[model samples]
Target: MLHHWYISHHHLYIPPSMTIHHHHHLLLLLILFLLTPPLSTSQNDTVSCPLNFDLLRRLVGSNRPSIDSSTVCRYAQQALRLVESDHLRRTSSFVPPPNTAESCWTAYQAVSDYFYPNFDLRRNCGFQTNWITVPGCMNITNRQQFENKISNSSLNAVVSACNQSLTGSSCSSCTVALSNLQASYLNGESVGNLTDCRAYPFIYAAAFINQLGPTDRGTAVCLFSLSINFSKSNNKHKTVIIVIVITVVIVIVLFGSAIGFWYSKRLKKLNRKRRKKAEINTVSALDSYTGSTTLIRYTIEDIKEATRNFSRDNIIGRGGYGNVYRGVLPDDTEVALKRFKNCSAAGDGSFAHEVEVIASVRHVNLVALRGYCTATTPFEGYQRIIVTDLVKNGSLHDHLFGSESLRANLSWPVRRKIALGMARGLAYLHYGVQPGIIHRDIKASNILIDENFEAKVADFGLAKFAPEGATHVSTRVAGTMGYVAPEYALYGQLTERSDVYSFGVVLLELLSGKKALLSLGDGQPVLLADWAWSMVRNNTPLEVIDGGMAECGPPEIMEKYVLVAVLSSHPQLYARPTMDQVLKMLDMDFPVPTIPERPMPLVAGIEDIERSVSSTGSAQLSTPRGYQAYTFEMDVRLASKEEEEGKC
Candidate 1:
């Protein structure tokens, strides 16, 4: 009966005597059951011992008669205890201990080994294989993809529970735990404890049973234990490789930092050397102008501090030369600072030339040069700055046509006064100085009005001295387009007459209240000089007068002033009056000179003359009586035609 019972239970036919002799197998099984530990009382325990014996019986099968049912029970019991203990430790009410994620992952690996001892975990587990290792489980390579998968799986509930229960500090502790697990797994270490492994038993069972092979149950169990040891050996090798990589990275970072520091220091030293060289050049340049007692030398630092480091708000004007900043001196004197544009040798020459010219001249109508500065700083390299008196009323161009407020204040008498003051200043520049100076750029914009409504001619950057016994200085043309005289613009022959001609253009602009260059809305620009000349030639000089003028004194005086302006701006350089004669005409010092007939060749328009002057600074001259002779020739030809018709 005992042999029959063994055959029925084990599904094997064993002899009665063999069963009697191996009766100790039952006793050994009993002892094994007695040695197994009981389950913990923790509420968070995931596995309970004494698992379904029927399920274990089916999983092991009756292939080996040497192994009894008790051994299978013992192995299952041990695995359950490990799973239960790990779950309890992980879900403990205290703060998470170190290596919690690693511990959880190892428990899951152990469960996988128990279920599928000889099967490849990656192949058999399908998508569930990642749960066997923390690095693979976490999907560190693509976190969003992992998250999306988790959201669609049963594991989502576990993640939601952790998020809902954890505070910010606890969450950070959890993150550290996960990071440690990932690091260990990357080094091929098996996590010893994994709390979430309890949830994957069903998945593991499904994959394990699908690939189960007919094998000895004892050997299968032994292989699972050996795999754990093998994993540990591989973990040590991976750890060594990881350590070497970290050390190499640290050494490289230290070397790179040292190189960066050395490069920074060398760059700073080079900048210091360049700055010192610039300062030396600046000092040498200023020394050349020290012989002049009138010129005051200033340092770059002083100008910067006075102008608030050249702030945009301090800028008063901008032109082709550069920006004009309003600044205050150490002596509490307000001044206009003209910072030049170019920093080349040509710019330096202009700066030095201007200093020499303004420093020598002393006239009320001319702008006073208070001081000068040459700076070569690291930021603004080799700068040339000129300081002049800050005119309160701004430029003549501003008052004549700028804003309505300015025009309202500038009465006709004030305009006449400004006109006379400008004439006096130019006359002084032409005749009062021994060698004389020709202001090549004489326009309304350059004429500044003072606090007392007096005119002061500023910007001597273009001024040149007329040498003794020389009629004109031949040089490159440099002046505003419409204001340049025909002789100077065409032939590059700069003379006192050229300046007189420019003044005449300004005078005409003032009288007519029009810009020197006027856009006629016909794709052609007309010169104020030509327009005034045409008005005078047509016997309508008063028509050219600005209607904005309130008190023009007398029509006769105004007309005479207009006639003098026209005669001074004649196309023929010889026909134009001198600065002295211009002043006399403005003051009614002598009768207005006879207005010459319009030169027929000169009637080609100002635009044409400008084009010709720009190309070659001289125009082809016509005879003094060229216009009269042409008219006479036309009349004689007409008379001959009339006599022929009468004969016919």
Candidate 2:
């Protein structure tokens, strides 16, 4: 022993060379010293911090050799809570002291060493490759898994784990570990396998202890380490499996694309055959109606020449159904050609027959239908065309609220004349026709003006015939939203009064120089009819007149006209006047009627109106009075004006 000895300043001596057996003995002594817990001042004095054997036993039982990321996170959270609770209980305060992190780290290290004698924090826990790296692991499913694990754990196990992690010199390391574990859990970071317990073995143990409670601590430790080692060894196998899966996916995509292309081609051929059959049927129907003289059937070539192959420059109007283009015939007669898009030949042929009957309807205020053409082309497929007299001044909507040039030309007198003409035209459709035609859509856009500014009612596509003895037709509700009559819109009850209601809305628009639907910066949009009614009910009918129309007519005359508009647009089907009656009131042929108090049922908000209008194809309301009322209100102001002018 004295062969070589070294002495330190502290007076401790060590032999420079020792026997192998002696060296082994010295290592055992050092090991025993490190394993012993720190001593208290008195031999009988109990250590203030004791290991929570019950918690460790529970954690060991619950833990699986291999666990998912969610299970790891749940265990981590439980360990942190236990540590926090124990800290508060011992300190008698909720707030953690400054040395809390150090204490937590120390406790965590001690536990790790106790569980796995050869545990390496950096090599096992710090290596990123050892953990699962799935993207979006913090999503709903992961959170749900965490909740389930916690819910299934024993309460005692959770409390014991927390207490153990918060006590003794080991507390500093445990506290630090707990904080790290909590952060990782919240962010949905993955914990490695059992052997590589990810810096917090106590947390991992606490989570699964209930499930693995029967296993001895030594066996649990051995199993955890083995599982981690096995996982590490399978890295190459995982890479191979991933490559195979990617290759299979590429094959699937290629096969799907090829099959889709073949199916698409077959569909196109079938569609072509169907289109050809439809075209033949349409031609046969047209030949049967060739005797009708009202509509002149033009050749496809003639239409093409007239419309300049449907040039974009010639387009005057565009709508959901089709486009209207200006065309010049070989005879120098200019016409408006409406080319319907996405129409089948059978549909076009039926429409042409209807056009033949509508063409027979001749009136000064109605746009004349010149001819029609139905054909198939190589590039454009089936074509449906309706030719009418070209009106240079465009639609009434264009002049009333269109371009500046058009508005400038529509003087107050011109506007009044246009309004009167529109009334007379609608009157002709509702009363003059043999089987009365109800123009389904009667907005300003349908009323066209010629070069002379005369109103020509057009667009009879949506019109329906009012047969003899039928007060109302039960057809599909179709029209512009704001201008649709509540009776017809809500119930699809198409009566002559429906047209009357629409005309009333238009009349209000004329009086106010506003759109049929007016937005006043409020939540709900105001219908022109509703706004006019409100003004009249408030006894401020003069306020409803357009400012630009101040010089259009006298206040008394304008007020009377506004009253006529409101009375005609009354929401009740029975309350609205007939189109003929509307014309008479506007022309001063009949006295303006006293607008009755709007029926309580009609004073609904905009949402109610929309709901009623959209509830088409449902049960309809009963028919109201089919006859028009003759009773009128004698306005004192109008009577005075008449007295002075000597025209009453």
TM-scores of the candidates in the order shown: 0.51, 0.51
Clashing pairs in 1: 103-193, 103-194, 104-193, 104-194, 105-194, 106-191, 490-617, 490-618, 491-617, 491-618
Model 2: per-residue Cα lDDT over 294-332, one tens digit each: 567888899889989888999999765578999999999
Per TM-score, the best of the predicted structures is: 2
Q: What tens digits encode model 1's per-residue C-alpha lDDT throughout 1-648?
A: 444323232233445565554766655655665566655576454333221223333333332112122133223323333333232223321112333433443444454444445433334323232232333222232223323433233333223322322221222222223323323333333233221322122122111221221122221221111001111125578789889999999999999998998899998888777756655655565566666456778898888987999999999887766789999888888999988765643245556778778887899999998888886668767788888889978999998889988887777788788889999999999899988999888988899999889999998877899998975688866676677776565456778889888898898888888888775586555667777888998899988789877666788888888898899887656467788888887886698866644333211223223334433311222222222232233345434532332110
Alpha carbon deviation, residue 508, candidate 1 (Å): 0.8
Alpha-carbon deviation at 99 in model 1, angstroms: 99
Candidate 2 ranges beyond 4 A from true positions: 1-290, 601-648
lDDT of each: 0.59, 0.58
Runs with alpha carbons beyond 4 Å of true place in candidate 1: 1-288, 602-648
